[model samples]
Target: MISSFSNNVYKMHQRTQIMRTTTFIKRRFSSAHITLKDSNYITREFEEISIPVPWGHLKGKWYGTRNVRPILGLHGWQDNAGSYDTLAPLLPNHLGFLSMDLPGHGHSSWLPLGISYHSIDYVSLLLRVMDYFQWDKISMICHSMSSINGFVFSALFPEKVDMMVGLDVLKPLARSSEKIVDNYKNCMNNIILHENRIISSEPPSYDWDELVDRLYYGSKKSVEREACKFLLKRAIRPSKDYPQKYYFARDSRLKTTYFYSFSKEVPIEMARYINCPYVFIKALQAPYYESRQHFDKTLDIMKQNPHFEYYEVEGTHHVHLNDPIKVAPIINSFIHKWRPS
Candidate 1:
């Protein structure tokens, strides 16, 4: 029997799933949409670094310039490096950015054949990304699900990051046993009932205009059409038969049932234990999954965390990447304050 709250949650979840799938199927590819300019100040370079996973090589790009200060940018789930393309321009000059597509998303190869994408695996991947760049310590800016990983990384390896900024999500700690069971049941229900299929038997070709519409109006709200095109290019690939088809390389099984309950005693304390300066930019309009009581308790842990500070932004989940004006300065200010003289 579905409780009223569970029923409401499932309805919202279904709507989101449908919209995402429709957007994924209809997304297009166009070179005219690539917005990164060949300017004097910004020098972009694409490079391939072996992630040393059992699967194979994972390609990443080093954006900005070689000599500039280094900052690592991690994108959200099912999103790629281009998530930063628009926001990167708004950042303060003189700092280099490294944006990498996580293993199962974007240009990077999958994790072998049978290996499923798990939340825990990202910790090791971040360390590998840091090691590949030869940066013993650096600053980080992350969005959505990636933000959770960033928080965990910061808590576990506080010394590695000089300062860290997380957008729209804090690292969620353990939940009550009932809540945990409910979440697990939902996941299992989804995996069993939902068939993970994006493209149709004959996928339709999409022009630039149609692609932008699906992205801007469909998933993201009030995003400029032109900016939407730029994101589409990174999100999609060219189809030979049709106009151009966009198919996400991210694993569909990521949506399947899974358990992520952690030890509340230690990890929440770990966030409190983070040694470096930390900033959390939360989305004001976002929904808190757990109840207000539990949510308040969790944030109380954050408030007590000495090295942490948080700011609320004016958007939905993907606040930072979607809106440059609100997020860019907050990131810049945090980094500027922490950067060495």
Candidate 2:
């Protein structure tokens, strides 16, 4: 039955979210604007696509038309492109939105055996994507873990990215020296363990409802029952050994991804290089993954950029998924101001 306090929390959000969603629907057209193309290629209209990488292909969903350069949408850790299912359609149709399954997530091919997924490699992957599209500049729209990636990428390649929008994160949390050492040790050990499982183990299968329950509790009730379906759509596949059962499609080794964190001073320096039009939305109810002191100091540096905009909204970590109404307006307005056609 998967009953727990977390499930109770999910029930609470569900009760509240229905009202919030209805309000959004009532004003959807006015908020989205009539200027949006009549035949917008978003959400249900999205095209399934794949981008070639060295090892294999990175699969994705392309929202909107192919003619114009699109914003690159990156999701959180362990989440696939479906993380944007609710938010993508709310975006203005002036440009496309390409939500790619980062390596090892969703339908994307996992990295070759033994090559641990590193944070910097995703930056390289973004560059490869740019090269494939032959675009001179990029506009990034990211959430959770990828928010940190966007921050680092914008800071490192200031001139290459035209704009960036991050949801609920600024950068990787600063770790204590001891924490860092322990994490490194644990990361290596986990990597070896997962590698062994990949070769010698068959993943356990769950029924569809059970899959939903796992996602609901797995996200600590941040993703409610209704919202779990979006992520699960891309996260699971039919099991070969079990009739009418499924297994998670993502790479198990991804649970041990080596996050590239820095000392406080480095992120401050990095923040200064981000000169593009940037928007960062903080979920007030979300945990501050790092020291607020570290976040505040780094944020102070970023605020110096003339184009930076920041706001906080009431919701949990997956607010963009669970209650997109609160965030869609900010994103639409930002896009209108910064990326006007």
Candidate 3:
């Protein structure tokens, strides 16, 4: 918000935690042991998985032993599951890690036409995933857009969440009524335009260097140049029309997401409902997207929870992926205290 394929060999493209007590429910999960990045623990394995939904299916990457209830990982808007590539391995052994591309974001199928993507829809989608796994209580690791989803989900159903860790974002952003109205209008217009383009046009394809450049600069250089490869793994597909060029496979409609901006009072009120063991890491350089007062107010309310931990780290919005070593220790601390394996 994030793969292994190199630009030199572009042919191959590829591809959480929790407090819910010691309930060990195992599914028929396929397990593989592969060495992850510079992980602090011994080798942790990963496998590619596809979870069925009514429309189509959602694809994901599962790391470590799948027999244990894994901490579900959610990436930022536009990013795929590979966003956790570096950070997953750094987690505690036996804790397990699972991350999936939200529909229209990675290998997951896009919503059928006529359904516009809303940030709040993810709350229901999270429920679908939980039912799929038949999980009783869940732990989460969310970044950016998904982080806000976690905030809303936790507020809506506080008892279902055992623990949560949000990176760089905490709630649905606040905006003036006029600004929200303008954005809503723009989103409606853009949805129709994006739909027409998708039905009638082929997306522009880019060379490998250009893809990396776009990802690096497009995120305002938040994702390091080298770190760009992890996201590119599941992001690009070799173009059928043009050799040596690739196109982004995700649904373009995600770019114009219709976030239902709430007033600051709503999120502050929502914060009071989150009683789970929570950790929020704020990247100092990231934009607030609104007034700092709005963020501070919500945070102050969340701080009232004794189990809630907050840290301000020096990095960009994608700090979890860019410099995971700095982020992992904070997470590890929360895990050992709340839901140790």
Candidate 4:
């Protein structure tokens, strides 16, 4: 009799679980757009468009409008358009901005099924975007890795980008010879694994709280708690099998070294050649890396470049995102002066 009662309880529990999962899925899919409001910023959902890339199609978000002044925005590695959640709203609304999720990040499609991601390829993608828009000139606001891309693009296509504001990491100069070999080896391994369909599966289901906590503690160490919540919208979704469970949409392989490794003479060379009106906001509190001399050498290039401007912002690497006051005015004034007369 007891055995039969226990079996009945187990079945009942399974049914309850199914009902919960169904409810969660309904809720998850129901709200696709979120309106964001803050002291000086108002944000609403933007449309997504797909553009063809060599490896595959890339998805991008259009913020503001085509009629507004044009500014192309780019986010950092592993970060999405959401990276600009705080700053985008602060920008002059009269200007239209296109903030894209580089391949392997955010809503942008990953490289064609078998291919791995490379930092250099993003520069080419930016060019394709310019061609798609038929934009003769673009103003740019880029953070971290994308900042490097912005500088490189500006250098290669000087007329294409009129002015730009780069937040931290203006250039990654002086990589050790050993590091270069290792990175190439790792990228090769990733390419092989990716082609072989050996990429890791999606992250396991987690609670919303746990997801936010991980992002805060891990990648977004400098982000404000309230601001961090905004990123959660893009990072999570209800699981089909569990009612209260949420899962990450990003590829699990994102954390692998195979996908991310520094190569020699990249952004450094890219930065030195930039000739457009550019401002570099260097973080004062954060150390460049294990080595400071190498970072100084890159800074020296910025020093020598006449068109390049540098500012020492008081915060960590991502400080501008959390405290816009430090970076917003710089962006605002630069745009005001550079906007076509």
Root-mean-square deviation (CA) per prediction: 12.1, 6.8, 8.0, 12.6
Q: Give lDDT tens digits, candidate 4, residues 1-341.
A: 22243233111110011111111101221111211223333444466667777666676667666675468778876667767656665667667767777777776666555555666677777767778777767788888878867766776777667888888776544567787677777666665564454344434777756766777777647655545554555555567777777776655445442322445456566556677788878777665653776666666776676766677766667765565545666677677777743
The 10-residue segment of model 3 with minimum total lDDT is 18-27
Candidates 1 and 4 compared by TM-score, better number: 4
Query: lDDT score, residue 315, model 1?
Result: 63
Q: Of the candidates shown, which would achieve the greatest lDDT relative to the real structure?
A: 3
Angstrom error of the Cα, residue 191, model 3: value is 0.9
What would the TM-scores of all predictions be?
Answer: 0.73, 0.88, 0.88, 0.78
- lDDT string for model 2 (96-123, tens) is 9999899999899999898998887888
lDDT order, best first, reads 3, 2, 4, 1
Task: For candidate 3, write residues 91-151 as lDDT tens digits.
Answer: 8876888889999987999998788999899889989999999998889999999999999
Better of 1 and 3 by lDDT: 3
Q: Give the Å error, residue 177, model 2.
A: 1.5
Q: Of the candidates numbered 3 and 4, which has the greater TM-score value?
A: 3
Error of 2 at 94 (Å): 1.1
Please give the lDDT score for candidate 3: 0.81
Cα shift from native, residue 255, model 4 (Å): 3.4
Query: RMSD, model 1, all Cα superposed?
Result: 12.1
RMSD of 4: 12.6
Model-by-model lDDT, in order?
Answer: 0.61, 0.80, 0.81, 0.62
lDDT of 3 at 302: 94
Model 1 lDDT tens row, 108-131: 776654445568787778777667
Model 2, position 142: C-alpha lDDT score:
95
